[model samples]
Target: MSLVKKFATVASGTLMSRVLGFTREMLMAAALGTGPVADAFYAAFQFPNTFRRLFAEGAFNTAFVPLFAKEIEAGGIDGARRFSEEVFGVLFSVLIALTIVMELAMPLLVRTIIAPGFAGDPQKYGLTVALATIMFPYLMCMSLAAMMAGMLNSLRRYFAAAIAPVFLNVILIAVLGHAWYKGADGLSVGYAMAWGVMAAGVVQLAIVWIAARHAGISIGFKRPRLTPNVKRLLWLALPAAITGGITQINTLIGTAIASTQASAVSSLALADRVYQLPLGVVGIAVAIVLLPELSRALKAGNLVEAASLQNRSVEFTLFLTLPAAAALLAISEPIVRLLYERGEFAASGATSTVSAILAIFGLGLPAFVLIKAFTPGYFAREDTKTPMVFAAISVAVNIATALMLFPRMGAPGIAVASAIAGWVNALMLLAVLVRRGHWGHDAPLMRRIPRLVLSSALMGGALYGGAIWLAPWLASSAPVLSQATALALLCGAGALLYFVLAFATGGTDIAMIRRNIRRGQAAAASMEE
Candidate 1:
C-alpha cells in the first residue's frame, strides 16, 4: 500500500480515539475539576501511561519492527515466529516481575518519581499511590501488546494495531459515563478510572493477540532466555526506548515540576490533549508506517526509496500540522472553552490558563510532528544511540527551561519548555541525518514548506480577526450552542482558507494529491498479487 493510504488508516483510527479521548477529558473535567483528587488521578495515570508510551509505542516498536523484518527476510515466517516467541517469553516474564516490584514500591514511586510535590499532602499522596498501584499492571499488558503490534506492522496488517488505542478511550469514556450517571464524587471517579485503565489494557492486549493469531502467527509461552536475538533486541531497545518516548519523558518531567503548583498539572494535561490530536494523527501515523517502509527499502539496498519515503513523511507531517499549529495559536481560547469550560472547569477558573497553555503548545506542534518524521531515519538504520543522545539533550533543555520559567509563568511555562525541547530534538535528528548523508534537502519539500508556512500565517491572521468578531458568541456567558457554533465556524473557515491558499500557492496541488492516490492503489495491487 502507499504510504499515504497507510497513514490515513492509522490516522482515522487515531482521530476516532482522540475524539473519544476529548469526551473522556470533558467528563473528567466535570467530575473532578482541578481538585486534589484530579491532580492525584492524573499523576497516577501519567506514571503508567508514560511507560506505555515509552516501552509500547517508543522503544519496542522502534527496535522490534526492523529486526522482525530482517528475520522475515533472513529466515522466513518460521524464523520470525521463533524470534517473536523468544522475545515474548523474556518480555512477559520481565514485565510480571517489574509489575510486582512496582506495586510493592508504589508509595516510594509516588513520593519520589511520580509526584514529589504531592508529598506535602498526605491525602493526595496516598490517593496517588493507590491509583498508581491499581494502574501499574497496565504496563505489562501494553508491553505485550506492543510486541504483537510490531509483529502486525511488519506483516503489513496495520489496521488492528492502529485501532487498538481506541479501546483505551472507549473504556475510559464508558467509565466516565457510569461515574456521571451515579454522580460520583472525585475520589470515586479517580478509583473507578484507574481500574478502567487497567481493564482497557487487558482488552487492548487481547485485541492484538487475536489479530496476531488470525494473521497465522500463534505465539505461546517459551521458557525465558536471553538468546542472541533477544540480547540484540535489548541492546537496541534500551536506547530506542529512551529516544522513542522523548515527549512522554519530557511530559513526566513537566508533570513533576507542574505538581508544585495547584491545578498546574491538570491544566497542562488539558492543553496536552488538544495538541495531541494532530501529533497522534499525523506525527504518530508517519512514524509507524515510515519505520517499516524505510527499514525494508534500506534492507534491500534501495537508498533512493528510503530517502524519498523520509522526505514525503516530513512533507506530510508539515502539511497537516502547520495549519493545526496556526489554528491553535489563533483560536485556542475558544477551543479550550468549547471543550472544557463547563461544569467544574468553568467555576475553577482554568479556561484562560488552559487556553494559554494550549496556544504555547501549538507553537511546538510542528516540531513534535517533525521529531516523529525524522527519528525513523535513524531507527530504520538501527542507529538508535544518536536519537537517544539528542533526546537526552532535549530533556535537559526542558528541565532547565521549565524550572526557570515555571515559577513565574506556571503551566504555560511548562508548555514553552516542552515546545523548545521538541524543536531541539527534531533539529538535532535532522542535522545528524544530513551530516551522515542519510538525508538531504528534497527540492520539492523545501519549496512547499515556506508556502505552507505562508498559507498557515494567512489563515491564522484571518482566524484571529474572526475570533474577535465572534467574541460575544464565544463568551463564557454566551449560550452553549452559540459558543459551539462560533468555535466551529472559526475552525472551519480557517481550514477552508488554508487549503485554498495551499492549492493556489502550490504548497500542494490536486495533481499531486491524485498522483499519491494512484500510487497508493498501484502499490496495493502489487502487494495483493
Candidate 2:
C-alpha cells in the first residue's frame, strides 16, 4: 500500500518484461542482422510502437491517471468508473476509425513517415509497407490497453499493467525462435514476427482488461459520447499526445535520420534496446508509481507528503540511475558484443556502432531518469504545457544536433544528439519546478547524490581498466563459453565493486535499502487483506 511496495511490484514486472525484451532483441540480431531486412522490420515495428509509447505511456497516462485519481478522491470508485467508461468508449471508437484509415493508407504512411530511406529500394520499401500494415493495428490494441493500464495504476494495482508488455516479447521470441530453428528466409521471418506483434497486442489488451474487471473496475464500451470529463481528458491529452514524449519522439526522429543510411536504423535500434533496459526498469518504475502518488498527495492537500514522495523518488532514481549510466558508459562495447555479436551480426561495424550509440545514450541516462522522476511533479498538478514547451525545445535541440553531427559521426551522432538534448530537457524541467516552488531539495537527497556520482565515477574508472584487461580474452578466437565467462566475470566484478565502494563510502545506505525492501514486503502482505 505504500510507495515502496507499489514501486517494487511495478519494478519487478517491468524487469521481467525488459529481460524478455532483451532476449527478443538478441534473437532478432542473429536472425536479421544489420541489413536491409533488419532495417525494414525495425522501421515497420517502430511505426506502431512509437504511437504505443507516445499515447499509452506518455500523453494518455499523464492526462488520465491524475484526473481519475481526483475523481476517486471526489466521489470514490463510482465517480471515477463512469468517467473512465466515457473516455474508453470515445477512445475505442476513435482508435478503431484511425486503424481502419491508417491500414488503408499504409503505403503513404510508409513512404512519408516510416522509412523514406527505403524509397529507392523497391523491395525494401514494399516489405516495410507490408509489415507496417500488419502491425498498425497494434496501436489500437495498445491504446486501449494503455487506458486500462492508467485505470489500474490509479487503483494502485500495477502488476498486470506492468507485465502486459512481456506478452509482446514472449510472442516475438516464440515466433522468432521457431523461424530461426527452421532457417526461414528473411521475409518469412519478418512476416511471422509482424503477425506475432498484432497477436501480442490482442493478448496484452485482454490481460489488462481482465485484470481491471477482476479488480472491480467495470470499464466497458458504449456509444461514443463527448461527456464533460471525456472532453476535458481529450483537451489534456491532445498536446500531451504531441509533447509528452520527447524521448520516444526524438528516438523516432533519430531513427528516421539514421534510416537514410542503409542498415543504420537497425544499428540504432540495437543500441536503443541496450539503453532501454535501465530506462524501463528504473525510470519507468519511478514515473508510473510516482505520478499517481503525487496526484493523490496533492489532491488531498498534503503538500508535505507530495514533496517528500517526489524527493524520495528522485533520490531513489539517482541511486540506481548513476550506476546504470556508468555501466553503459564503461562496458557498452563488451555488452554489445557479448549479446549481439554472434551469427549474422558483424562485430566490426554493427556491434561497434551499437556500442558507440550505447555509450552516448548512457551519458544521458541519469538525465532521462531524472526527467521521468521530475515531470510527474508537473503532470500531477495538471500542468503539462510547461513540460510540452520544454519537450519542444529538447526536440529542436536533438534535430539541430543530429543534423550537425550525423554527417560527421554517422548513426552514433543521432544518439549523441539525443543525449545532449536529454540533459537540456532535464535542466529545464528542474528549473521550472524550482521556479514554481514545486520542487523539494532535501538534505538527504542532496548529500547522497554527490556521493552517488563519486561512487559511480569510481565504478566507471574500475570498469574501464577491467574492460582493457579482459579485452583480449573477450576478443579471443576461443570458444563462446570463454567469452561468456569473461563477460560475466567483468560484469559481476564491476557490480560487486560498485556496490562495495558505494556502500563503504556512504553513498548509499545498505541498512536503509534493506529496510525499504523489507517494508515493501510487509506492506505487500497487508495489501492482500
Candidate 3:
C-alpha cells in the first residue's frame, strides 16, 4: 500500500477515537466539573496511561517492531513466530509482576508522582490514591496489548492495532454516560470511569489478539525461559525502556510543577486533552504505521525507500499539525467554553485555565509531531541510544525550565517548559540525524518546508485576526450561537488561508496528493473485496 493510504487508515481510525474521547471528556466536564472528583479521576487515569505510554507504546513497540521485522526477514514466518512467542512469554511475566508491584505501591506512586492537584485537599489526595490503585492494573493489560500491536504492525497489518484504541474511548464514554444518566455522585462516576479504563484494556487486548491470530501469528504463555531469543529481545528493549522513561519523566516534571499551582492543575489536563486530540490522531497514527515500514525497509537495505517514507511522514505531519496548533491557539477559549463550560465546570476560572494551557501547548504542536516523525529513523536501525541521550537532555531542560518558570507563571509555566522541551528534543534529534547523514535535506523537503512555514504563518495570522473579530460573539450571552459562530469563522478562515497559501506556493504537490487519495481508496476497496 502507498504511504498515504497507510497513513489514512491509521489517521481515520485515530481521528474517530479522538472525537469520541473529546465527547467523553465533555460529558465528564458537564457531569463532574473541575472538582475533586474530576481531579481524582484525571490523576488516576494519568497514572496507568503514563506507564502505558512509557512501557507499552514507547518502549516495547520501539524495540519489538524492528527486531520482529528483522526476524521475519532473516528466518521467514516460522522464525518470526517463534521469536514473537518467546518475547511474549517474557513480556507477559514481567508486566504481571510489575502490575502486582504497582498495585501494592499505588498509594506512594499517587502521593509522590500524581499528587500535585490534591495537595491542599486531603479528601482529593486520598481519593486519587484509591482510584489510581484501582486503575494501575490497566498498565499490565495495555502493555500486553502493545506487544500484540507490535506483532500486527510487523506484519504490515495496521488496521486492528490502529483501531483498538477506539474501543477504549467508546467504553469509557459509555460508562461515563451511564453514570451521568443515572445521576450518580461525582465520586461514583469517577470510579465508574476508572473501572471502564480497565475494562477497555481487556477489549483492546482481545481485539488485537484476534487480529494477530487472523494474521497467522500465535501468541501464548509458555514456560518462561531465558532463551537466546528472549535475551536478544531484552537487550533491545532496555534502551527503549530508558528512552520511554526519559519521555515519561518529561511529563512527570510537568505534573510536578503544575501541582504547585492551585485549583487549576486539573484544568490544565483538560486543555491538554483538547490539544492531544489532534496530536494523537495525526502524530501518533503516522508514527505507528511508518515505524515498522521504515524498519523493514532499512532491514532490507532499502535506504532510499526508507528515506522517502521518512520525508513523506515529516511532510504529512507538518501539513496537519501546523494548522491544528494555530487553530487551537486561536480558538482555545471558545472551544473550551463550548465543550466544557456546563454544569459545575461552567466557571470563568475553568475557561481561563484551560484556554491558557491550550495556547501554551499550541506552541509545541509542530515540535511534538516532529519528534514522533524523526525518532523512528534511529529506532528503525535498532539505535535507541541516540534518542535516549537526546531525551535525557530534553528532560533535564524540561525540569530546569519548569522549576524556573513555575515560580513566576504558575501552571502556564509548566506548559512553557513542555513546549521548550519539545523543541529541544526535536532539534537535537534532527541534528544527530543530519550529522550521521541518516536524514538529509532532500529536494522535496527543502522546497516544501519554506512553503509549509509560510502557509502556517498565513493561517496563524488569519486565525488570530478572525478570533478577534469573533470575540464579541463568543463572549456574548447566547452560548450556543456565539460558540458556533466563533468556531466556524475561525476554522473556516484558517482552513481557507492554509490551503490557498499551500496551493499558491507549491507547498503541496497536487498530483502527488491526488494519487495518494486514489491509492488509499483503491486499497480500501481491495480490503473490502
Every candidate's CA RMSD: 1.0, 2.1, 2.7
Computed on alpha carbons, the lDDT of every model, listed in order, comes to: 0.91, 0.87, 0.81
- Higher-lDDT candidate among 1 and 3? 1
Candidate 1 whole-model C-alpha lDDT, 0 to 1: 0.91
Model 3 lDDT at residue 132 = 85
Model 1, residue 168: distance off in Å is 1.4
TM-score per prediction, in order, is 0.99, 0.96, 0.94
lDDT per residue as tens, model 3, 266-376: 777788888888888888888788888788668767788788778888989998888888777767888888878888788535788778889989999899888889888
User: For model 1, what is the alpha-carbon lDDT of residue 251?
Assistant: 94
Candidate 1 lDDT, tens digit per residue, 1-529?
6788899988998898999989999988988888788899899999999998898889777999999999999998899999999999999999999899999999998888989999999999999999999999999999999999999999999899989999999999999999889888888989999999999999999999999999988998999999999999999998999999999999999999988898998998988998999999998889889899899889889887788888888888989999999999989999988888888887899998999999999999999899999999999889999999999999999999999999999989999999999999999999989999999778988999999999999999999999999999999899989999888888888899999999999999888878877876785687578
Candidate 1, residue 448: how far the Cα is off, in Å: 0.6
Question: Which pairs clash (backbone N, Cα, C closer than 3 Å) in model 3?
Answer: none
Error of 3 at 505 (Å): 1.1
Clash total of candidate 3 = 0
Error of 2 at 44 (Å): 0.9
In model 1, the worst 10-residue window by lDDT is: 519-528
Error of 2 at 323 (Å): 1.0
Q: Which of the two, 2 or 3, has more TM-score?
A: 2
Q: Backbone clashes in each candidate structure, one number apiece?
A: 0, 0, 0
